[model samples]
Target: MQETLFCLRVGHRLPYSMSYSNTTDFTNPSTFILLGIPGLEAAHVWLSIPFCTMYVAAVLGNFTILFIVKREPRLHAPMYYFICMLAITDLVLSTSMLPKMLSIFWFNSREIDFSACLTQMYFIHCFSVMESGILVAMAFDRYIAICDPLKHSTTLANPMVAKIGLAVVLRSAMLILPYPLLTRQWPYCKSNIIPDTHCMHIAVVKLACADTRISSYYGLFVLFCVKGLDMFFVALSYTQILRAIFRLPTKDARLKTFGTCSSHLFSILAFFIPALFSSLTYRFGQNVPLHFRVLIGNVNLLVPPMLNPITYGVRTKQIRDRLHQLFSHKDI
Candidate 1:
């Protein structure tokens, strides 16, 4: 969708407008005014340094994951394939929101056309949901490997893994496609200033000049279906994994199993805890500072993509060795 719209500005800015015309003449605002981060606009310059560092680190780290996974034929298994998918999701999600965020912070470029805002929200939410699914798939793979090793390769072969990845992407896109559409139809007669950096589903939806119960409930529904369900299954899979681990005969065997899962455990916590906390805080923490909420939001979005590759580098021997080899060659 092209964001280059010819807008006709009208009416004074109301923070929460609730007057929709009874007759139908649907026209969207030409541009949305994003406030970047309320109460911290003065520090946007200082903010950009860290945000830029995060963006650079996230891009470089995820690219390294992609490079290593693609370069080494030996790493072309289902596990790495899933990790690669993870890297892709992280890359896309971060890229979708952050650049504009940085532009807002650094350049005061906050006017996003209605279509562009909707497009950004769609990818951000879709990739976020897709990420949860990828994590679920990773947990399932670990479950089968640890609990049913004899059937691991056959069950999650190349074809099966490919299909699983495809299904996850498709499922997320199908479910989340309605989100942008729902908000797109809303009348934005009031203030278009989003409190945060980017166009989140709720942030955009909240701008509607109507009773937004349906959109709000629908957003909650998508959240439950995406993050809620994925986390439930992941927790379930880990419960079984722990049960299987304790049943191992040797102490060393159990420790070894723990070692195998430590990276994934760390990655899961790194991604989910901050994200869950951020969302919950926004939803429930009435006293939390808007700037604080915005900080957590940035961490939840940027940190996982930045850390996933680092986790692989520290835990996976193949990735570590490959990094060493590449750097060593570069030095020469």
Candidate 2:
């Protein structure tokens, strides 16, 4: 008993704690301490300002998109349905981490229970995957709209979009289900201090006292297979879309048609660029600063949710008109 207590106390300070033995069961930690951002703890308070701003914007913007879509009868269409799904995905993704991040930064409440940490990790990745899938679905919507205009309504009906949204949700959940289960089996004999804002699969798995090759390889597989395939489809769809757009005889016609896709394209960039950058930084950026990597990871979730609604609001004619009418003290 005394030895167990000694080990537990020492585990809090050291990165690698007592080695796992065949006879011992070392599964869960009571609580994991989030260090916010290692090597930049002094700046956490100031850093909370931008983080807080992004969270607030994400909440309001996504909620506004949902509200506008729900209330406006004319806005009920396949495209808007997809946008609503994306909004919900973004809200969950950002909400999973940002509030806890703010707590860590502002109030210094950094301890996350094991189950809660796993839940956060699952929600973050699951919704992230859902967002990527939704983006691909949006790309396909754009493809059918531009490439096969006559068949667009028939081919991508509201029912079909709803089905696609369901598929996205199911696929995301199933893919991420293994993450927490695998993490739970691992023995976390290392220090409980997570040097980032929230629990990530790789971050948590790395603390395991046992071999984590399975977890690492599985994470990479999901990243490359699921997200990679989603990216490929988006690219292919856009390729066909651009081809169709350029085929329009008049310049004005082509520009007008292409303008419809501008928001989705920006949203794709906003989501994937930072996600890829952060993933690469985490995996291969050994020389990169830890704080920068954590910040980039946070930005990956934060910026997209905050930007998506704004992008769609300003770009979509129906949405823009409704917003102006709703907020201009005019009858919506």
Candidate 3:
């Protein structure tokens, strides 16, 4: 059985304690201290440098994509519009975690206030949902273009695309809003250590004095409904897209369409596969090595932002050509 000991305010500190005999047990402790960056004491400088480098790269890369889409009139289309939305989402996603992560690594301050921690969790989930929606929109765009070429323009006109984008943002925001709000309402005892680097939703909920059975069930339901459904839609879209491609009269046209969607396919895989593993690891495999768990966690958070621009730029010839032209002109 599990027990929660909530310590009321006594001066500026509160005391909370929990003990776990096995990995499956959540009732064992109310709070576990998060030891950020496992080998921090001995080689703090070495660890901080790489983290900072990745943060900068993630920011710059995502912003560059955003700028190119906004400034270039020729690149204005439904496809690039969705790409811009994705770039913006990645920017927010990275910003949500990187600043605090950098501070923790450089200054060795892992003490995050309860309010700020919940806020971070909110933005993280919000942007994550936004990214998933954008990918689904992109897949739908591809499906219309490949499967219904004659009506592609009529089906995905500017006005229709704008509405779709707005709907995506609104729906995602609504889906994730409840999670953070519910998490913040739970009182935290003095023992406020988190096992992971960031304030993960599951880890935070486990600290609550109130029963978290409803929260956990709601979270799993939301996870399956959002991520799982989006992935299934993407797969279904590609199935029709592939079928249409094979039916094409000419080989060149099939290859051209394939090239257009290749980046999206790569990005979809990169984002979802690591996320699936991270979720499974947290839910089922607590005994796994902490470093390995952390590595998977980072992959879900960092890899998507870093890979988005590279994958899109490489696969989309127009973006690649524009980048080349910009660099070549700068050399002169």
- For this target, which candidate reaches the highest lDDT against the unseen true structure? 2
RMSD of each: 5.8, 4.1, 5.9
Order of candidate numbers by lDDT, starting with the best: 2, 1, 3
Our model 1 lands, by Cα RMSD against the true structure, at 5.8
lDDT tens string, model 3, 47-122?
A: 6676667777778887888877776788898999999999989989988987777666677566676667877888
Candidate of highest TM-score: 2
On residues 254-290, what C-alpha lDDT tens digit does candidate 2 reach at each position?
9999999999999999998899888878888999987
Tell me the number of clashing residue pairs for each predicted model: 0, 0, 7
Error of 2 at 292 (Å): 0.6
Q: How would you encode candidate 1's per-residue C-alpha lDDT over 1-332 as one tens digit per residue?
A: 01111011211122222122212234587677776777777788999898889889989999999998898888999889999999999999999999999988888887788899999999988998899889999999999999999999999999999999999999999989988888878887554656778888887776678887788888778767678888899999999999999999999999899777778878888888887888777767789987798888888899898889889888988889888988888531
Clashing pairs in 2: none
User: Considering only N, C-alpha and C atoms within 3 Å, which residue pairs clash in candidate 3?
Assistant: 14-190, 16-190, 18-29, 19-28, 32-193, 33-193, 34-194
lDDT scores for all predictions?
0.82, 0.88, 0.76
Residue 133, model 2: lDDT of 97
lDDT of 2 at 16: 34
